[model samples]
Target: MSIHLFNKRTALMLTLAATLTACGSDNDDNMTEPPPPQPEPMEYSYDITVVNLTHEQPLSPITAVLHADGKMWDIGMSSSIALEKLAEGGDNTDFISQESVIANASAQGPLMPGLSETLTITTTDELATHLTMVSMLVNTNDAFSGLTNLELSTLDVDATMSWHLAVYDAGTEANTEAMGTIPGPADGGTGYSMIRDDVDRVSMHSGVVSQDDGLMSSVLTQAHRFDNPSIKLTITRTK
Candidate 1:
């Protein structure tokens, strides 16, 4: 009888131990954690080359933006205040800060006519497929050039794309080319003002009618006159 009782007790103890072991194993599983999720990888990179194509116009420090489809400025549309400042003063601060930019870059200084400079940009997303570059013709009143809303998806790695940009009038001010109204080395005049003295929409810049071209009040000379394709822009994917 004692043997029988001992066997029964031992069996009960074994079952209890098995039950506890099973519970402990489940607890361990509950406490264990899964690995963290990984982030999506990005693609594509670019190297932009801007060649100042004008004869004497000193281009402002160039600005390049990487974003989705859309332009930084448009003809017939009112310009952004950022563009206004850039056109008037050659200031790139606000232009660089404009929203919708996935990535951007700027030249260290002005790209003198007949000269060239390069700016580079990288993106984590190849989906970022549009490009815009802008700079002012420093010797004129609100004359700016660069490509806008250009599609970049078709450009392949190590490949290059180019454009001959045209000058546009921001229409924020008159092309008086008058003294103290023009910025850049020619006059080093006022860059920006609160006055909206010209047509409020952008349009093809009537090539500068400098002091030599009959705008007697013009502070600019014949050397400052310019035309379309004032600059050559090349964008290459480096990585």
Candidate 2:
């Protein structure tokens, strides 16, 4: 072969190789990476309503809680200090701050007789599958009413459940209905006391013995008395 021909052929081959390499580089530069995957957010919500059915007994501020499967209180069991505080004094700060609580809501103030209040609670926790509600019968000593450990996992969106709650004695204080021991507007007396002077265990409350009922020392009258199913509670799933 002649030198000139061979040199020409070699130049053409080198040019083809360079063109191919350039095309490949251009393809790489024009390519784009896919966007990062996004995560889905989760939320759950509920609304709780409490109605006072008493004639004159004012209901204390209501505490509504959502938590995992567990009972806050049981009959025949001693009351926790948190429950004691709420039952005796209408203080729910400790009950709402419990470690097991996933979310909580409270009423602004005491609920007057024949009145109702609604509270809403929301949470992102998937483990929260139970509900509890509590409030005191402010006219009596250590008297409270509510439901506990109510299963919520089966509750559907926009669905509701209702109950007529009965009163329970915290067994932390005596129901003297005396001049200085009752906490309601009927007496404006002290609320909670650490002293466990009563049975020291939770049980169904025996209705109050008011001054009209022959208890002379009692500060409460027939007007301050209440019976079972003192409050009507309703729960709805909003989300």
Candidate 3:
């Protein structure tokens, strides 16, 4: 009888131990927590259209940028090498790579007179609240047209703004319009020279005086001449 009672007590103890072990296992299984939340996404986008209004000059491929806050070209300030490059050769390589440029886009090829090109620039950074657009009148010497540091923060999605951009002299070259001096089809001449030959300050371009207009050495004709408001620029926020 004592043996029987000992067997029953041992069975009960074994069952209790097994139950506690199973409970501990269940507790461990329940301790797993859920994953943390993810951050929200952000995006901003803009569509820019530039129309070449010149009678004959084909604009260099357009360069448009969305930045935080800074002027690429300010009147009375000397032109950056990048600006000079673009103004002279229509090469935007250095201009688009500016440190202040948050996002940028460019036209595929020359923007011919009476033609328009539209490009879209997008960024995940909402801080890019300034827009700049630049292009060279390929038929002249250091003549460029564009808008700079125009405020974009208040522009709502789908909203639009427009500007008739005036031409500006890059001030890095002379406007002699001489043979082998212009970079366009008229001469296909040298584009940029490091020497600061002209008035070394940014200023409104006193329109190009072609060969027909009395600049005797000019390779260009009256058809290449241009005045203020050379480009019709329109900007629309897309996102």
Candidate 4:
């Protein structure tokens, strides 16, 4: 057959398939004829702003992932090994590439205390409807800040959404704020360890009890301590 005839035949088959899938829905009733082939999916873009509100803790480079179905982290569960790397070492490369994510972005440097940073992610899938933001509070051990399973459907394009996010204890490492365990400016010590300590499951951070607050083994002073909602996150659907 001629190329034009073959093309027409292929388009006719696709239209038939789509009509069958619609199964007499209202959409099918309206489609009396086949429409032109669709282009690739449109991209959805968003800007995520993270403000570090701690007294002295510096946030590691922010990790933002866009997925269709689920959260990257959850409370009362042991973190994934990828999460352990990000939580303990401020490395998001592995976490964002985890199979759970469809699209991802990360900030370049630490968001210092009282400072802010913005990370942007774009997805071509309309199925991408959930957001998860993650970053480490690098002055301590296994303490990280961010949100999981933040539904983004109700938010309209060009509208802004904000949240005061809480911190979490990644149950991969011990919270011993000793002299050489922290990996931030406060300690410049080691990052990931194979040992599992503390409650072996994720939970709300109890806030740091530094040396000044009577954790005798904690090398951190009052300056290294922090409370809830350490990060102010504002998300705007840019496109």
Q: Model 1: runs farther than 4 Å from truth?
A: 1-40
Give lDDT tens digits, candidate 2, residues 1-239. Answer: 69999999999999987887687778897644435576765788889998999998898898999999989999999999999999998999999998999899999899999899999989988888899999999999989999999999878999998999999999999888899888888888998888889999999999899999999999989998788899999999999
lDDT score, residue 82, model 3? 97
Per-model TM-score, in order, reads 0.82, 0.84, 0.84, 0.82
Question: For candidate 4, lDDT tens digit of each residue in 26-137?
Answer: 5566655447689977778999999999999999898898887776778888788888888888888888888878888988789989888888899888777899999999
Q: What is the lDDT of residue 177 in candidate 2?
A: 85
Over 4 Å off in model 4, which ranges? 1-37
RMSD of each: 9.9, 11.0, 11.2, 9.7
Report the alpha-carbon TM-score of model 4 versus the true structure.
0.82
Q: Distance from true position, residue 71, model 2, in Å?
A: 0.7
Per-residue CA lDDT of candidate 1, range 1-239, in tens?
A: 99999999999999987887688778795643435588768667789998998999999999988889887888899888899999999998988887788888998989888898988888887657898889999998898988888888788788987778889999999888889998888898999887889999999998888888787888888898777889988888887
Worst lDDT run of 10 residues, candidate 2, spans: 31-40
Ranking by lDDT: 2, 3, 4, 1
